[model samples]
Each structure stands twice: as structure tokens, then as C-alpha cells.
Target: MSDIRDEMLRTLDRIVEANLTIAEREKADGNGPSAKLWAALTEQGMTALGETDSEIPFADAMALVARSGYHAVPVPLAETIMARRLLSRADIALPEGSITLAARAGGQANLVGVAYGGTAAHVVVADGDSLHLLQVTNAVVHNAYNQAGEPRDTIDLGKAKTIDRKPLAHATDVLIAEGALLRSVQLAGALSRTLEHCLTWVNDRVQFGKPIARFQAIQHAMAIMASEAAAARAAADMAVEASEKQADWFAVAVAKSRAGEAAGKTAAAAHAAFGAMGFTREHPLHYSTRRLWAWRDDFGSEVIWQSKIGQHMAAKGGENLWATLTEMN
Candidate 1:
């Protein structure tokens, strides 16, 4: 099974690299994923990994999303897979094109910062206890973009009518957990790529007739960046493993918190190493770093998840804390 997953991920990486180059990503930047890229992903059967019959296990599906992040592919395939699975479970006919998830509490009809909201054809919104499928075109979309130039639009559900509806208990919590896990895996992938860019920059840039990589301080910072990247990826892998079982909020909370923290550290280190070069739009480094910054805050920020972890530990008390924490999900 692991062999199959590795083969699939390698194949996915190839497809993404071949089809969505930095130039292509830029062509569709601030708008959404280009049609050509989406076509390539769909033709490769990369969109239905989470569906039971797709042969790709749910945990493996998470890995695919992480791989997409590595290439900085500007698409919401994570939401598309999860949304289709939810609709499938509800016996709702799946719609074509991309679908984004928007989970919110209470009866808030307006969803702020809906990832891929501007481009996706449909949105599966978990509004408190009920799930709603609405046409993105029907909604009043206030155009917006994240720091990475990915479409992060404000969707007004007030004007839109639900195409399908179903009762889903604890829908908000379920969707939030899903969002956090997906973002964490993505963060992990982006962190690794960011580290790679930093390493390459440090090795190539000359300082005082010597590569910056020769400097002890530079090497130390690079080492820390690598460690954070490794830890973030490990946390993401653990979260995916947890999905094979209960996939509770606790598992995703840990992953999101860790990965988000890693993103901050990794991005800062990359920018510091690259100096003014990293901050420029002409540099490829910003592609991954900006997404890392935006995604870490999307589902839930590291601060929010860290506080949740603390609160959960406090409730368990000191005696059972280690056992409970270790055993979570």
C-alpha cells in the first residue's frame, strides 16, 4: 500500500511540474488556477482521490494535496475532493468544475475568505448543523485574493439559493477539522520547498568572494530551517495517518499548530537568507512563502490551535495529560 502511494505521489509530482510552471502560475495569478492546469489534473484522474472507488486511500489523498503544495499549484483540489465525498455521502449528484468548502458557525450567510471562491463552480457550506451546496455564480462574490495571489473571495450566501441541503450534525466542527488538516499538509509541503529555495540561494549567492553557505552563521540558520521543515512534514504525515482512523479535531489541531509554527519560522529564515531578493516578485521564493503565510492562517492560525491544545490539556489535568495527549486520535 505504501509503495502504491509513493508511486502515485511521484506521478502527481511529475504531472504538476510538467503542466504548471512558474510562468503558468503567474498567468493565472490573483485569478485562480488556469483552465489548462485544471484540465491536466482532471485528465490525470487526480480530482477524485478521496472517493471510495477511486482506489486512492483517504490518507493518501492528503498526501496528494501536500505534493500539490510543493509545486505551489494554485488550485483548491483539497476542497474539491472533500466536497465531492461529502456530497457523495449525502447522495447528492456531484457537479462539475471546482468546489470550495466554507464552514461557519451560527447562521452566518456571508462567508469571508472562501478559498478558490472566485473560481470554483460550487461551494459546500457547513452552516452550523446543516450542509448546503450552492452555485458560486448565484452568490454575490466580492473579489479578493490572499497574500499568495490565490483567490480568497468573500461569498454572500444571502443572495444565493441552495441547490441541495442536508442535515449534518456538528457540521462546522467537522469541516473545520478537515480544513485544518488539509492546510497543514499543504503547509508541510510548502515548508520543504521554501527550505530548498533558501538552501539554493545560500549556496549560489557570493559574499566577500565566498558563498554564503560557507558562513557558519548562515549554515546554522539553514540547519534550523531544514529541521523545522522536516518536523512540519512529519506532523502532516501524522495527521494523514490519523485520518485513516478517527481523524478527530485533536489530531488536526496538533498538525495545524505545528505546521503553522514551522511556516512562520521557515518563511522568516528563507527571507532573511535571501535578503531583498526573496521579497521581490521576480523571485520564485515568494510563491511558496506567501502561500505558506496565507494557508497557515486560513483554516485556523497556529495561535488558535495552540490555545486549543493548552485548553484541552488543562481539562485533562496533569496526571493523565501525557497519556491523553499521546493517545489523541
Candidate 2:
């Protein structure tokens, strides 16, 4: 099983590296989700990983998602997978194209900062113990973009009609947990890519007849970036493992908080190492770094998750703190 998973991830990495070009990133800047990308992902069975008969593990699915982030692939791939999985849990038939999840309020749902919301065919909202499916056609959408230039729409369900409504198998907070986990995985991938780019640039760029990478100051900066990236990867790995074992909120919280903290530091270090070139639109480094900035705040920020962890610890008291920290997925 591990062999199969590794093979799949390697394949995905190649596919993303080959297809996710500068042109594709520019195309996605103001556009909705790409049909071509969706077709390719669906053909690879990447979109149906969470379906009942898909046979793909949750951890493997997240690994693919993280790879997508590494290449800075412009799509709502993560949201679509998460929406499909949640819909299945609620016994709702999954729709074609992109799908996103949201929370409903008072016969209406105002889903803010929804990735790929503008292009999604349907929206799944959990209201109390019921899950409601709403068509995108009926909703008023205010299209927006995040720091990464990815679509982050505000969907107004004030006048929308429900396509379907059914009893929910789990709480809506489950979506938040899963969303945070996904973002953490993506942040890790992007940070890794950012570090890679910085390393390459530093090694190639020379000053005073020597490579910048040879300088102690530059090497120190790269080391810090690498450390943050490593920490993020560890957090993402733990989160995915925990999710696969069963939804462990504590592990999820720790993963997001840790990864979120790493994301900011990694971005800052990458920029510092790369210098002015990293900030330019012509440079591809911004694609990874900007996404890192936007994603850290999505689902839940570091502050939010840190508070949750602190509250949980306080409730558990001091003696059990070590056990809680040492507990494995």
C-alpha cells in the first residue's frame, strides 16, 4: 500500500510539474476553475479519491493535494475533494464540475472566501443536523481573489433555492477541521517549493566572483527557511495520519497551528533569501509565497487554532498535558 501511494504521488508530481505552467498560473488569476484541469484530474481518479468505491486512502489524497500546491496549480482541487467526501457522508449525490462546502444561516448561507466558488456547480451547506445542496445558478456571487490571485468568492444564498436537503451524519465543524488540515498540507508543499526556488536562485546568483549561497549570511537564511519547511511537512504528515485514523480534533488543531506558524516564517525567510526578485510579478516565487500567506489565514488562522489548543490543555489540566502531547494518531 505504501509503495502504491508513493508511485501515485510521484506520478502526480510529474503531471503537475508538466502541466502547471506560468501560462496556467496567469490564466487562473482572474478566471474561474479550469475545465481542462478538472478533466485531467478526474481522468487520474484524483477527484474521486474520497468516494466509497475509490479505494484511495485519505492520507494519500492529501498528499496529492499537497503536490498540487507545490506546483502552485490554480484550481479548487482540495475543496472539490472535501465537498465530495462530505456529501457522501450525508448521502448526497455528488455533482459534476467543482463543488464547495459552506455553513448555512437562517434560510440563507453567506459563504465568504470560498475557493472556486465562482465556478462551482453546487454548494453544500450544513445547517444544524441537516445538509443542504444549493445550485450555484440560484445564488448571487461576488467574485473576489485572495493574495495569491486565486478565486475567493462570497456566495450569497439569500435568494437561492435548495436543490436538496438531508440529514447530516456529522457536525459542520468537521468541515472546518478537514479544511484546516487541507490548508496545512498545502502550506507545507508550497513552503517546500519556495525553499527549493530560493536554494536554486542563491546557488546560481554570484557576487564578488562567488555564489551568494557561499556566503554565511545567505546560508543562514536558507537554513531557517528549510527548517520551517521541514516543520510544516511534519505537521501536515501528522494531520493526514490523524485524519486517516479518524477525525482527531486535537491533532488537527496542532497541525494547523504549527503549519500556520511555519507558513509565515517560511515565506518571510524565502523572500529575505531571494531578495527583490521574489517580489516581482515575473518571478514564480510569489506564486508559492502569496498562496502561503493566503492559506495560513484560511479555514482557521494560527491564533484561532492556538486558542483551541490552549483551551483543550486547560480543560485537561496539567498532569495529562504530557500524555496529550505524546499521544499518537
Candidate 3:
């Protein structure tokens, strides 16, 4: 199993991620992830990596997503994986091409900020009590990009009939929690990569007859960045494990909140350590940091998930808080 995991990671790093050049990312920002890349991913069985029928274990699937974050794949790979998993559990046939989830319904069943919304062949959206699977060919698509230059568009399902529908077992809030879990894991991977870049830059950059990494100030910043990245990775690991066991939404909320906080702190520290170069497009640091900023706000932001955790704890009262947290451990 470890061998398989290592091989999988290598394939992603060498094949899927290595080919995602700056030019490819620029093209992806204008058009969606290239069809060739998608085809390559499909051939690797990555599109359905987490589905019920997949031979890959859930933990391995989640690992793939985290690696994607590290590489800043700039594709809807994570979205498509989750979409396939959701549809499979609901006993729906997986659609061809890319699939992505719509945001939790906002009053009128319109899903906005959908990853790959502009190009996805199908979208799974929350509609009343049902999860509506809509074919995107006829829907209204407003093409847009997130702060990270990833495709995040609005799709209005305007009178479209559901190709297949299933009763939503969980509330919209639960859906957000699930999305948060995914984003948290992805953020963890991005944060880890950002820290790596910062460390590399500081070690190689010399000033005042010594490497910047030798300075106390830079050392302190690097320590903070590494700690935050570690925390994010731990939180994401907790979320993935809990998800595999079918734990409640509270566990997911905790993971999302902690990871989001870590992402913000780590991004700031990394940028500070890298100095002006980190901010430029020529450097790849922006790729991870920008995605961290965008992803931390996606699903539910840190504040939102923190509120959910606080509210639940408050209702449980101060006395039970220790027990509740310990139980998770």
C-alpha cells in the first residue's frame, strides 16, 4: 500500500503537475483545464479516485488532492473527484467529462462560485430537499475566475430539469461543512508548499555577508511559518480520517477552522520571508499563496466555521467543552 501511495504521488508530481507550466496555467485561467490534461487524469483513474467504485482507498484519494494543492494543479481535479463520489453514493451514473458541485442554495437554487462551472459537463446543486444533477449545456454560465486565477463561475440552472435527483440527506450547512473539509485539506497542501518555497528562498538569498536564513528575524518567521503549515497538515489529516469514519459535521468544522487559520498565518509569514519576489508573477510563491487566500474563503471561511464550533460549544456549555474535545482525540 505504501508503495502504491508513493507511486501515485510520483505520477502526479511528474506527469500531471510537472506538465502544468506557467503557460498552461495562463491558458487554464482563460479556458478551463486543458482537455489533454483531463484526458491524462481520466486515464490515470484520477477523476473518480474517491468514488465508491474506486480501488483507491479514501485516505489515498484525499492524499492525491493534497498533492494537487502542493503542485497548484489549477484544475478541477478535486471538484470532479468529490462530484463523482457524491453521485456514486446517491446511486447516480457518473457523467462524462468534468463535474463540479454548486454552492449551497442561496434562496433561489442558483449556485454561484462553482469550481469549473464554466466548463463542467454537469453540476450537482442543492434544490429544496433534493440534490439536483443538472446538465450544464443549456444552463446560463457566467465565466469568471477566483483570486487565485482558478475557474470559479456562476451557473444559473434556470428552469432546467434534473437529469437525476436524490433526496438530500443532510442540510445545506452540512454540505458547506463537507466543502470546507475538502478546501481545508487542499489548503494544508498549499501551505506546506508555500513554506517550502520560503525556506528555499531564505537559505539561498544572501545579504550582509551571510544568508538571510542565518538572521534571527528570518529564522523566527520561518519557524512560525513551519509551525502553521504543520498545524494545517495535522488538521487536514484529522478531517480526512474523520470523514472516512463518517464522523459528524462538528469534526469537519474543527478541521476547516484550524486549517483556515493556519493558511492565513502561513501565507503571511511566507510572503514576508520571501520579500518582494514572492509577490511577483515570475515567482511561483504567488500560486500557492493566492490559492490559499481564495480557498480559505471558499466553502466556509475561518470565521464561519469558527462560529459554528463556538455556537455548538456554547450550547453544550463550558463544562462539556473539555470532554467534547477530548472525545475527538
Candidate 4:
């Protein structure tokens, strides 16, 4: 496992370097960079990493994506991985670089203004008690906006073809859990990078005859950011482990909820530390902070996850709540 993790870290370093270059170019050109990065990832077999039936390992895969978040790479890791996993379950072969997936809200099939719909080849619709897979061949994809100035859209899937089959046992739940965990991991990475960037900036951009990082207030804020990043990473790891083991859904919910809160708070703290510079479009900190905010609201927000966790615990009764957690671990 350690060997695999090390290999993934090395791969992630290469990916991050390349992605940073591409992201800079894309930002200059004013185009969405996710598609190009997705093509690169597909070449590297990223989409297939955790989708196989042979007890596929996910730790390395998760680590790679988390690092991608650190660099604010625009690739759709959650969407692509979820699509691959779902298609694999349904015995569908997803062509590399040709398939895209995204999560939509509101339990309605024809709703618009969801996340990352413009470049998607397919959309995963999670309605009540059922999951619908719709191909976006003829769908109208509007060039909607997200925080990073990335291309999002309101997909019109009314005329699109659909699959009526029921998903694999607990498939929707697992996908949601796994997607949230992945997003959380990415948020942790972004938060860590932002905090590091702020600290480095303060150290070099001296004020008052000394580095701003020397100030007690800045030090405290940095400490909080570091602690929150660690907590988010730990929670995300727990979610990933639970997903790998096919543990109870409550574990995933708890992990995701904690991670979401951490991501939101940590990003805000980092931005505050960086002051107005972080808000400028010319600065790179906004890139990470914007994505952090957007991703936190994706794949079941903190409030939603907390409600789900509470409901699960209540359903299990007070006596069985602790038992459920233990069993999941």
C-alpha cells in the first residue's frame, strides 16, 4: 500500500506540474481547462483506476485527485470517476476522454443550472429511489458560470435518451458518498496549498520592518488553517476507507459533513490572511479559494450530509448508533 501511495504521489507531482502550466495557459486564453486536463488524465488511465471489479485500490487514486485540487487543476475527477464506476456496474464500457459525468440537484430530470454540465457526455441523475443515466447527445448546454470562471451549464435532457434500469444495490448512495469524499479530499488539498501560499507570501512580503508571518495574529490564523486542513484530510481519508470497505453510509455522511465544514472555514481563513490580494482576479489565491467554495456546495453540501447523518442515527435508535459507527469502521 505504501509503495502504491508513493508511486501515486510521484505521478501526482508530474500531473500537478503539467496541469499548472495548462491552467495558466487556459486562464490567459479565457477558456475552460477541464476538458484538456481530462484528456490528459484519460491518457494516464485515471478514470479506470477505481472502477474495476477486482478489488481496485482507491487510496492512490484519491491522493492523485486531492493533489490536483491543491493545484486547482480544472479536471472533473468526481464526475469522471463516478461515471466510470456507474458504467462499470452496468456493464457499460466508457471510452477514454469521450465520456464526462456530473451530479445534478433537485431530484428532477429536466432541471437546469447544475454543476459542470457544458462539457459532459452524460449526466448522473439521482431521483428518489432511482438513478437515471442520460446521454447528452442533443441536449442544449448553456455556457453557465462558476466561481473559477469555468464553463458550467444548464443541460436540457428532456429530449435525451435514458436508461430505466435500477442501479446496483445501494449504488446511488455509494456514488454520493464516494463523490463527497473525493470532493472533500480535493478541498483539503486546496486548503493546504492556499495556507502554504499565504504563509510564504507573508514571510516574503515583509511589513512593519519584519515579515508579517511574525505577527501573533497571523501565526494564530495560520495555525487554525493548518489544523483545519489536517482535520479535513483525516475526515476525507476515513470516507475513502469506508467507501473501499463498503461500510455503512453514515460513516461517509459524517466524514463528508466534517470535511465540508473544514473546507469552508479553512478557505475563508486563508483568504482573510491573504487580505484583499486573495480576492483579486489577477492573483492565483482566488483560483483555489473559489474552487473550494464551489466544491463544498457540490456532492451533498454540509447541511445535507448532516441531516442525512442525523436521520440515519435516529433511525438506528440511540442504543444502535454507536454500534453502527463501530461496524462501519
Q: What is the TM-score of each candidate against the true structure?
A: 0.94, 0.93, 0.95, 0.86
Sort by TM-score, top down from the best = 3, 1, 2, 4
Q: Which ranking of candidates, highest lDDT first?
A: 1, 2, 3, 4
Model 1 CA deviation exceeding 4 Å by range: none
lDDT of 1 by residue, 256-306 (tens): 999999999888889999999987889999999998999999888999999
Clashing pairs in 1: none
Clashes of each: 0, 0, 0, 0
Task: Give the range of the ten consecutive residues with the poorest summed lDDT in model 1.
Answer: 47-56
Model 2 alpha-carbon miss at residue 194, Å: 0.7
Q: Who is ahead in TM-score, 3 or 4?
A: 3
Give each model's whole-structure lDDT. Answer: 0.83, 0.80, 0.79, 0.68
**Per-residue C-alpha lDDT of model 3 across residues 1-329, encoded as one tens digit per residue:** 57778788888887765467778776775467767677777778777666767788778888888998898887788888777777776677788778888646567646677888877888877555566678876565577778888887776677445799887666355456667878888998999899889888999999999999999999999898888888888988888887873325877788788888988888888888887888888898888999999999988899998998899899999999999988875
Q: Candidate 3: which stretches are off by over 4 Å?
A: 159-161, 245-247
Cα displacement (angstroms), candidate 3, residue 147, comes to 0.6
The residue-by-residue lDDT of candidate 4 on 109-217, one tens digit each, is 5646444565666666555445567676677556666666655666676776674445455555655666677678888788788888888877886789998989999
Q: Candidate 3, overall lDDT?
A: 0.79
| lDDT of candidate 2 over 1-329, digit per residue (tens) | 48878887887776666676778768877676656677777788777666534578777778888887887778778888777777777778877767777765344457777787777888777776788788866565688989988888787777566878888645467777777887888988898899999999999998899999999999998888888889889988988887873456777788889889988898888888778888799999998999899999988898999999999899989999999878864
- In Å, residue 90's CA in model 1 sits off its true spot by 3.9
